[model samples]
Target: MQRYLEGELGEEQFRPLRLQNGLYIQRKAPMLRIAVPYGLLSSQQLRKLASLTRDYDKGYAHVSTRQNFQLNWPELERVPDLLGELAEVDMHCIQTSGNCIRNTTTDQFAGVSPDEVVDPRPYCELIRQWSTLHPEFAFLPRKFKIAVCGSQSDRAAIYSHDIGLALQHDRQGNLGVQVLVGGGLGRTPVIGSEIESWLDIKHLLSYLEAVLRVYNQLGRRDNKYKARIKILVRAMGVDKFREAVHREWSKLKDGDNTLTEKRIEDVRAHFRAMPYEQLDATAEAALLAQHDDPIFKNWLKRNTRGHKVAGYRAVTVALKHRDLAPGDITADQLDHLAELADRFSFSEARTTHHQNMVLADVRERDLHDLWTALQKANLATANAGYLTDMICCPGGDFCSLANAKSIPVSDAIRDRFDDLDYLYDLGPIELNISGCMNACGHHHIGHIGILGVDKKGKEFFQVSLGGRQAESPKIGKILGPSFGASEIPEVIAKILERYVELRQEDELFIDTIHRVGIEPFKERVYG
Candidate 1:
């Protein structure tokens, strides 16, 4: 960075180099992406992030879909100092972006999920250590992402990543991984294909290394348009891709990279059980208070989630303020969250891919108290998975790559459907908005997806339906042409009217879309 600043390095040479370290030159300023390893952060790390946001950024930072934090206004020269502070907290920005292995994400409920096959965090940690600054895999054709999920339900969106690992057990009760390859979003969204039904536990790292080696060698590098691993999979077909991976794996399997029991146990030791109480979780007062306190009941219904422990419940503190941008938290709020983590969640807090924070170990009895504190901090919006709890990007306001604005569109939708009763009846929906084809906002996976486009330098919004990003990931289909910005809310309303009328007794929005298809939605909106 100093060499570039001193004019010894050209912009083209310095651009990729700086991006590998998680720095991006945005439209107005430099944005620094700080990787929070697998979305896990201790109280000290959270406080350090808070301090950085307060000191370097504009009093707030955006939590990205990759389970990382972005400070948008750091001075170029002060970055070293900022990174120095981050290192003191055992944090850095290495391999966060560019053509390298990005952060390895996993189920935020990894060890705590009730139906988990095995804890995947130890595996995730092992991969993190191996992938960081890996000399062999660095400078790949394009950026890469990996996700791991141990639960029966995939909350990690494993099917939408470059490489996905699902923990599994055979009839003989041997632990292993279900390896997937070639999944990605962006311009050409594709679901991953299973390369190996069950890879042995010992060969996990070597198998992953084999996959990356294939991608690095065979994947396209000449054209930026067709550079991702997904394109390569599409070009060669899944059968050929799997064959290549197996051919490569045959040579590297059971080598030095193979896992050992002691090493795996040592990595697992970092994520031992928290101090949890043994009492039964009646949540007695909270359930009883529900009769009179509608607000608490509403929050309880949406924000809090089930815990594996008897007395605990994981709480999602929503960051989707109606007035502000979604997935945004202020420096002061980060500080408050650090305090809350210290008091309630064992000095640890987690960031989710859904752009929310999780106090994963909150006592069920203390939920009301936690809700009160969150409300005070303006982080207590009880709209998780609701229509108003939308996923959105910074859009044209901040991103140089955006074609149109997104935050305003999101706010317009939230304002149009502000009634909690109406949203509750609408059921859980993933509504994602992207400012461009980059799909950073993950519009392709939204049950109701919105995209912004530019035609003749005028902004327009396009809508799609039926996309999902769970265990069964599917890209959304477009609903005819784009609409003027003013017409989006009514188009959305019309679509919802059809959903309300056509949905079965206990069907979700995505389920209804799948059952009925996009033809009905097209007729309602166009007519």
Candidate 2:
């Protein structure tokens, strides 16, 4: 960094080095992406991040859909110092960028979810250790991403990753994984194909190595746009891709990369059970029933989820405030959230792929108090799983790659649909906006997807329908021609109106699209 700062390093030489360190030269300034390994962070780490934001950034940070945090306005020269500070808390930006393995993500509710089959964090950590600075995969054709889900619900959005692993148990009661390959979202959205129905957990690493080796060898290197593993898989066909992976696995399987029982147990030890209290379940119900405030009831129902433990709940700290960009939390909010985590959730919190934060182990009895604290901080939006709780990318405002600005579009939509009761009437909807085709916001999987496009150097927004991110994930279809930015909200309102007219009782927005097809929506929006 000193050499580059001193002008001793050329642009060609420093470009890859800075990217490897998670520094990106954006539209406005240099952005630093800090890896929050599998979205887990200690309260101390959160405080450290808050300090960095205050010192290096514009007093704020953005949470990404990949469950990472980004500092948007850091001085290029001071990024090294920021990273040094991160190191004190055992965090760094290694492999967060570049054509290498990025952070592996998983369910935010990994250990606490009532639906979990197993904790996926151990495997995520194992993969992190193996992939970090692994010489062989340092320069793949393009960036590679991995997601793991050990729960019945696919909260990790596994179907939209380079590699997706779903944990399952065999008939003989042995834990194993079902591997899916070629899944990705971008210019070409592809649902991952099941390459392996079941593989013993012991062979997890070895199998993953074989798959990477195959991609590293055969993935396109000539055309950057055609370089992702998904493109290669599509061109080769799933059968041939599976055969190629198997051939590679035959060579590397049962080798040193194979996981052992002791090795798995060792990593698992790092994520031991939290010290939970043995409070009665009925007591929790009674305590919750005491809250007469309808607003509190709405927040409790929308922003909190059931926990595996009897008297615990997973509280989602909504980052979707009208005053702030979606997924953005100020530095002060970071510090206060750290204190909240300490008091309520064992000094730990998890970032979700939905661009929200989760205090995974809050006692049911403390719900009202926690909500009050969060409300005061402007973090309790009561919009989780609603239209306003959308996943959006930092577009032309911050990203040079964007054709149009996304933040304004998101803000407009939020302002147009500010009524909580109206949002509840519409039910759960995934509205994702991307500045470009890169799909950083995972727009392709949103039930209502918006992509910013350039029309003769001017900005226009394109919409898609029927995309999903969870179980049975599907890519949304383009609704029609692009519309001006100012027209998006009215267009969306018309689409929702059609949904309301066509939907069956209790039907979701996506279900209505699927039932009657996108034609109805297109007609409504265009008419």
Candidate 3:
């Protein structure tokens, strides 16, 4: 795969082809990311991923925030062979790297989420085909990501994605999408500005083409760091960029770029809803009895969410435990998850943007048994939406791009806020940590954002306030001076302490911050 993407080797190659793709080799090994198109994988395909990790790489698979899989491995030369095997299963790493389009991500729960007015799988598939090895986009300055979220809840973390598409229904009940462009994390993480209010589903592809066309034509080429679509959007202003897109789209809207009925149907055929079984009442009662136990109950409450389908649930396995690298899992863990999926839960698992894993369709009756098995493996963490369940990136410790090491800070914060009750009481507070300005950790969208910076060879973290990640998105405002790693936990604790003191009952952290401004919390945290 590396050789193919690099144009270094072809199908009939030599020994020089036996090289790693520079995919971050660690003491743990090289992490190879597999692009899963549209977040949709059949049970058999998912099982193959589990088997691949179990056999060649580590024993677990890390589901990326981008709806792809990353296997931590050591053998670089084996990548091509591994990729070759993946190809047999109808998968490829074609656009997974380089300046081309990265993975096309969509809401993890797009089709199943009842709150969605329409399924976005078709649109995602269309974009996936159009962008795969797209000649014009292959040499863009930096990586690109596109996400579609049809659900009312922003499961895709649309605000932080490079190109965010929210499927919306017009007053006439016509399906369209609200397009947001240029928002990104990584250095200079910024929330994307909206370019189109409502675009008909038919013009979706053409509209996207128009936006990319404008970006491709005008985006900065001198600096790799400043070349993202966000920079272009920011420079031109959303109105001006929209106008440019409108002018370009006018030429292409009714042309071949438009989504055709046949094309839509062909893509839709691949994304047909999975066959589900009727809810089992006995199983539900039994699981409820088992969950009556305190620990099991806690796991159920924290890690499990209600599924639209009866007798099933969306189970999150939190990877936010202290001392464990956030988003890192072993190949053995992947095998176990696959086995669990095959036996007790649905024959499937999901990866969330929050750096967590999900057993998407666990039978209610098997919840306790599943939890028990997971607990044995240290995989069952009851902190999914809590303060401890932080979204973090592989900061300076791994990435050459990082300004500071974020893992240590995350560990320190988790250690200080280990109390489950306190976390539950706080309710859905997001503490996003990014190692650098790239904002891969989505510092801009966190309720309490932490961005790492390098100042005179020392690490400092900048705190931002009032960022929210739901339907109405808002970027965070920077607080005062950056704090050292050691001071982060205390600063975060003090800030939360103020929120507790000032907030009304059931008011979320973001709401309170918005209402009170950062003064009270700033004084408390900095004092």
Candidate 4:
């Protein structure tokens, strides 16, 4: 780093080195992405991140759709120091960029979700250890991403990853994984195909190794645009791809890379259950009945989710407050959030792929108190899984790759739909906005997807409908031609109005789209 900063290293030589450290030269300045391994962070680590942001860059950070925190506006020369500070808390940026294995993501409610089949953190950690600095995969066709989901709901958006792992139990009661491959989103969005119905947990590492080896060998190298594993898998066809993987697996299965019971147990030990209190399961209901403040009640209902443990709930600290850009948190908020985590959630927090923070083990009795604290900090937006709680990218404002700005579009939508009662009436809707086709905001999977486009060097926005992120994930269909940025909010309003006119009782936006089609939406928006 010193050699590069001192001009001893050329741009070509320093490019990969800096990218491997998660440093990207953006439009405004250098951005540093700090990995929050599987979205987990200790309160101390949060505090450390806060301090780093204050000292190195602007006094704010953005939580990316991948569940990593990005510090924009950091000086190129000071990035090494920023990373050094991150190391104080056992965090690093290694492999966060470059054509290598990036951070493996999973359900934010991994251990606490009532619907979870197993805790996936152990396996995520295992993959992290194996992939970090692996010589063979250091330079793949392009960046590789993996997602694991232990729940039936598929909250991690597993279908949109290069490799998706779903945990399941066989008829004989043995734990195993169902593997999906070739899933990705960008210029070409392809839903992952099931490559393996079931594989014993013992062969997890060996099987993954075989898959990576196959991709490393056969994935495209000439055209960067068509280099992702998704393209290779698509070109080869699913059956042929599966056969190739099996042939490769036959050579490596049950070898030294095979996982052992003891090894799994060792990794599992690191994620032992949180120390929880034994309180009545009905305590939350009792408390809610007594609370007359409708605002607090609404926040409680919207932001908190069911937990596996009795008297405990997973609380989402919304970063999508209209006052700030989506997914952004101030340094002061980070410090206060650290304190909140310590007070309510055992000094640990998890970042969600939705760009929010999760306090996974809040006591039911302390619900009102936590809400009060969060509200005061402007962190309690009471809009989880709503239209205003949109997923957006830092577009032309920060990213050089962007063709148009994204934050303003998100702001306009949020401002246009500021009524809480109206949003609640509309029900759960995912509005994801991406600056360009890279789909960093995961626009491809949103129920209402917005992509920024360039029309003869001028900014424009394109809208899509019916996309969803869940067990039966589907890519949204583009509604029509692009519209001016100023025209977006009205366009969306018309689309929603058409849905209200056409929807069945209690039907979701995506369901309405599926019931009819994008034609209805296109007619409404264009008309």
Candidate 5:
């Protein structure tokens, strides 16, 4: 700290150091990102975050795409005090940014997803402990992201991360992980490639360490833009990267990091099964009410998702209300959410990468009352996975790296397509808007991506199509030419109109594009 004040450290050296502690000097104020490992938050931890936001910031915090909470405004000097407070809640902003092993993210419905192959939270928790303040890989070539998923569906969007771990079982029923490397979505977005189809859990940690060691040693550091592991993997190709990792792993095999059955069991014990209520004859009433009430049916269709526990459902509380920014939640609303989570979700809540919160253990019988409570609190808009449930960055409005305002574009799209029935017809279209090429909004993976660009110092938006963040993830393709800020919504409408006309019956927006290809859509838009 003294060396930094004495001008001994340059901006390049000090900037990354500060970012490692989650402190960023934004255009207007300093922003601090609080790590929420695996997106798990107890009611008490959430209340503490609420208090910190109210005291240090503008009474709100933004949930980021990495499943962390970001406080936008704080005095740089006072950041330590807030971090100290967060430490009291067993939380700290460590390795959230910078070239370090960042917070490990997982499926919001990790343990409880109906299609889960394994309970991934325990594994994620173990990784969180193993990597926290890890001495060796603290300052690597560039920032790294790792996501774990246990479900049949890729809710964690692991393919878009630097290291994606999808838990799987071999033919002999032994548990292992399918390892992927090189995936990212910044200036150069690329979906990760599989390096190991199924690595035994005992050797997984060592293999991961080997990969990181290889990347740390060989990844480009001279050019920050090309420093990411994705760049390295692309340059070397997946086969060569795999061989390097294999060579390194052979040296480290059966070393200290090798997993033991006792360690796995110990961590699993912490995540013991939730107390689930047995479904009685009353379960029939909940299903019947959906048929009778159109609003309830719509809400059920969008907000409530399947849970492994038969009598329960995972409920997504929409934070994309038109009145608020996509990821912003007021301190008061957070307090209320904590209270509601205590009552409904066993004192727990989880945040999604798409800026939504989930109550993962809500019983079906309590849906009506919970929905009513949510309605009063403005958390029950029922727009999960819809066109209006957009992923937006705090563009030129707050971020210094942004080219133009992104929230306004998100707001405009919401307003233009406000009809609920119309949104349902579109069917799970991901409309992500990034402020700049940084891809903070994950625009590269959206079905319909909008990037904020500057043309002669004027705000212009570039559009992309057919990108996805699933098992077979693909980067979006540009639609040629940029549009004025005011012209974006109309442009989106035209594309949607073309999609509606070209799509086969009940085909999804992305599926239709895959079948028809980008050229046809490009012709319709530019024709």
Candidate 6:
């Protein structure tokens, strides 16, 4: 029996006992989650993590939804030792695998986002320390996730996190956060219902503690699958939940744990902004003249986003593979990206939830050279946010939890729709694929949702339509019956062809679907 976790073992037989068949007895594996503060990491940190994975654990590390790295290896006995190594480099695996306070996540575009009111790094670092090794909330009913976004674009995907905090200012000009609770994904995915419209930053940690306490006491522990705080929030109405959280919050407010100005300043010191130089004009013109190719132009248009800087852009190296495994970057590919970040982007790389690597703070004119280098590295897939850029899980291929294989399905869809212009014409479509009912790929919120299911002995896919992820969040609706793997591409093609035919000029797929209704799409595809 796995008894050491419950404090029932001598230190001698530790490593061999804690991990039985790679299952760490909690969730799945003895996963080591490493924080990449604000999704920004030095190339050195990335290389070290890569080496750590290659040396200590599995050859691969999974980039989590919360912008952290989770390595699936090492013995539970060696966890303390692993923590010690991580601490040597100012990293830790504490609260990464437990029901206790987990790592706090923030927007990938924390500092550089053009739309941000202020950098959320200070807030994230402050909350991170408060949550780390929090004693009273160690044993909870279920896992909890928190995300903070300073951008209107919601780069952190705050709408779908367990506790989503959006930094905003009130009319009178005071900094505050708009908080959302209970949004989560798993067996049942839900957009978190809003609880607090505006709560000042000083009360952030205490308010969060109150909410967690309410959930810890009320959340269901009997059914592991139904134990998420979202279920609890839903079962007890939102208003009642808010009332309960307020009741708990009133007790914890301003009692020695109030966010002090000095404490905030201490955390801020650790996150001093990276040094940046003024853009060079001569370098910009030389870059443009060097690579005026059509492909490079498309890469420039789709892959690069506006940076807060005058002459720089944030480059997204999209891993939303046409048919390949999402978030699967080879070791060689990793090295190449690191080099690119060092040379072109100001020594920082960001890992996005869309499973893309971002080279933040790149000069606009140097885009062509960057593309040429990326092409060599196979990171130049000019489909950043397009339909071919499908967000897919390993499904049956790697994940033991999947009901069907998602890779092949994504591949089939990509192969059938190979024309880039046709994809561009379709415009701003989100196609998310999941192998099972568990929404790891976030199929529920995709413009075109594909869920792999088992019907009798054969695998099939069920399609959904009209979902979107911009400011106005809407869940997609199921289109119709399940189709065989072979039939998926044809069905998708039929739906898209119908969309192109019916859409007004410049109408996106999501807009066209919403304007024309799903019945037209369903009839065309199923007919």
Query: Which of the numbered candidates is closest to the native, going by highest lDDT?
Result: 2
Worst 10 residues of 2 by lDDT: 464-473
Residue range 110-209, candidate 6, lDDT tens digits: 7887898878888987777777667777767877878888877776777777899989999999889999998877677788889999998789889998
Q: What is the TM-score of each candidate against the true structure?
A: 0.98, 0.99, 0.90, 0.99, 0.96, 0.89
Error of 5 at 168 (Å): 0.4
Which candidate would rank higher by lDDT, 4 or 5?
Answer: 4
The lDDT per prediction is: 0.89, 0.94, 0.78, 0.92, 0.89, 0.77
Error of 5 at 193 (Å): 0.9
lDDT of 5 by residue, 13-115 (tens): 8887788888887879988999999999999998999899899989999999988999989877678789889999999888988889999999888888889
Worst 10 residues of 4 by lDDT: 283-292
Cα misplacement distance, residue 245 of candidate 5 (Å): 1.0
lDDT of 2 by residue, 327-421 (tens): 99999999999999999999999899999999999999999999999988999999999999999999999999999999999999998999999
Q: How does model 1 score by TM-score?
A: 0.98
lDDT of 1: 0.89
Q: What would the per-residue lDDT of candidate 3 be over residues 210-316, giving only the tens digit for each residue?
A: 88888888888899988988888899988998899999988999998788788888888976766778877677867587556787888888888777777777788
* Regions more than 4 Å wrong, model 4: none
Residue 365 Cα positional deviation in candidate 1, in Å, after optimal superposition? 1.5
Model 1, range 425-521, lDDT digits (tens) per residue? 8899889999999899999999999999999999999999989988467999999899988899999999999998899999988998988899998
Clashing pairs in 6: none
Q: TM-score of model 5 relative to the true fold?
A: 0.96
